[model samples]
Target: MDPNQRPDDERLSAWLDGELDSAATAEVDAWLREHPEDAARVRLWAADRDALRARLAPLADEPVPEAWHTLVRDGGRSAAPAPAPRRGLPLAWAAGLLLAGGVLGGLVGAGVVWNSPELQVALQARGWARPSPLAWTHRAAMAHAVYAPEVRHPVEVNVAQGSAAEQRAQEEHLARWLSKRLDMPVKLFDLRAHGFELVGGRLLPDAAGPSAQLMYQNSGGQRVTVYLRRPEAGADTAFRYQRDGELGLFYWTEDGFGCALVGNLPKERLLALAEAVYKQVEDGIVRTPDGGASRPDSLQPAGGRPAS
Candidate 1:
């Protein structure tokens, strides 16, 4: 089906990108039959996809970056902050050179650089750097950013194809645990329709903040994570995305809730998942404030946001 000419054509494109569901996919197929021009557009999309697969499909089987070992060994910092890629598993190639030199690497790797009592002390060391200057919380987001993409050992439990009842049960456990911590109802989505399959989840401690990460895998083996927390007493925060390595992150605070989306998926797919989760949350399906009821728009955008 031509994704370019559907009523929600933009959405259709996202879906064809494997971001849509069975319902939308069928609708697109039907539409394409009626609109030959649209069909042509879909054909072009398929060709582009084929070309990309031909190019990148090989990387899928490449070694899963053995360098990831170094990061965990010394307790890597969450992806490292601004402009700095950090000294651990996900360090920049240049940093690897520094590590080889032994002079710059030892001091930073010792944990004296980034863990100083003051920012100045941490900054004094040369190898103490980041891919982006991020707040500690953002670094937490970065941690998820790095490992969630693994093809092997990506998660503890991958519930991607779990039965409906099983999925709901997992979400139920997630909600109860999260609710107790944040004093809010927590929701989990089966966004397979949106191209992410639940890959189980975990709770971790952050030097900056504690967090919950729900991992997911896509057809491309790219993994996405939804990180949640309660940052402070109460606040509604703006949603924002940060890029690390080849992946992008979408994070925001809403009604005392904190969330981050980390993945290599297209910006559109990431945003679509965020919007859907936000909607379910607002609709009382995922999380609920005292009196608010969920609506269809819960999965929709508002305030001229991209998908509105």
Candidate 2:
């Protein structure tokens, strides 16, 4: 098949799910080899599917509730119609619900982990103090996928052009403007040591509020994006990793900021970049060679925001 006529995402997702027959799988493999981006996306979807399965796997082993057992033993009749057995796993339905409503949705609500002892145990085992921020992480990957491929207008602020002084000014303006808008410090991380340079950045509207997206590129033209937003208050801060098809994401929250690095680079390479951004953000300063800070005089016009 012609590369331009590559299969749509449904076919790619089906391939990841092992739903395709051998010939179809082989076709997908050929297409992926020719189109790295699509392959990466499929990998991410597979990773996410696996992670979801792992998180919910324990639910499958929990025995049907006594209420359910009573109903079953009584030939599907009951003196009082017992509410849906919270203790029973209903694994298949739950997985479908997660896929439909979202992974974190319908799993827990308010202070109730569905009022299931088994589910509570599973949550504890999973180290979930609250609903996972997985839904937001998915959004981050989507944002990267949508914007990183653009040949032009990949960023709102064009900081790579103009004279040296003008470029510095633009960078400063970008940092300060995003910082002000986001209500937190936004630092422009320099990744040149790792063979990536600042391309520019854009403002994005997030589900929670305004967010920032910084784009970078290597000499080979491979692009990566850094997504930043204020995390939900009291959210977990542990670093996490997820991949779909060709894209990999390393996301974490710290000091009220949620950050995700999305790229098609190998894990080690992406980790290097993630670590660089993490360290820079933790340090809370982005310095120039002169050891003096530069600030932008005004905010540049912003491109339209992408969906969260």
Candidate 3:
């Protein structure tokens, strides 16, 4: 297979579901080894599938409702006498009814009901059916969990891979490549001021599009990740914090960009780091290619405060 030829979503999904033959599986495995973004997306899909299955597993063991059995036995006809067919009903009305039935069936199969607030909350709590802004924040957290623990291959582009000059060049390239792909400014945030140094970054997939994750490590080997993505139109720009088990996340939207910092650090420590990032971004401080900082004139000040 050509290196540049990528598998489509159906192929990847098939690979995830174990629907592919051994040869095709091997090919997908090899391709995933070279493409972290696609691997991440597939992993997320698997996680969702597993979570959904686990959530609904008990229901599978429960006896079917009597009403459902009756409905099935009746071939889905109501117990009440079928109203006399209206002979004058238009074909368009029949088509519309078919479309509505199809849509309703899909919603039911997916466990969604317009009036089921509790069910909707349950789904959102498991990181499903979130609005655009919250959805990407969840992805940021997932990316951090997936990559932050790796010892040797945490990032696709390792800034610490070479000499001083080469490392600087790598940092520049990481910033540039991510910025280009994200269509937003990507800053190699100077976290050394807070005891963390850049370890490089990688591109990841977001719900809407591409996203980037920059990893940083402290002297104690503790790592945190900064996730960046272009903001969806009308996304809320307020600073917010969320906790997912042991991970603490600080996320916000600023200057047409969405940023989230995720780590296993204490809330205070993570907030300090998030504040540092916020300050640098608000000041428009872009880390230069030659290991320096420059504020582009195009950038203007933006105001926001962390949510209490």
lDDT of 1 by residue, 52-92 (tens): 23333333343434345555565775464334435432333
TM-score of each: 0.49, 0.53, 0.59
- Candidate 3 — which residues are off by over 4 angstroms? 1-134, 288-292
What is the lDDT, from 0 to 100, of the residue 243 in candidate 3? 70
Model 2 CA lDDT for position 51: 45
Per-prediction count of colliding residue pairs? 20, 11, 0
**TM-score computed on alpha carbons, candidate 2:** 0.53
Q: After superposition, how far is residue 168 of candidate 1 from its true place, in Å?
A: 3.5
Using lDDT as the measure, name the better of candidate 2 and candidate 3: 3
lDDT tens digits, residue span 176-267, model 2: 89999999878888787888888889898888789999999999999999999989978777787877435788888876688999998898
Residue runs of model 1 more than 4 Å from their true location after superposition = 1-136, 145-158, 161-164, 207-209, 234-236, 283-308
lDDT of 3 by residue, 211-230 (tens): 99999999999999999998
The models' CA-based lDDT, in order, is 0.54, 0.69, 0.73
Deviation (Å) of 148 in candidate 2: 0.7
Order by lDDT, highest first: 3, 2, 1
TM-score-sorted candidate list, best first: 3, 2, 1
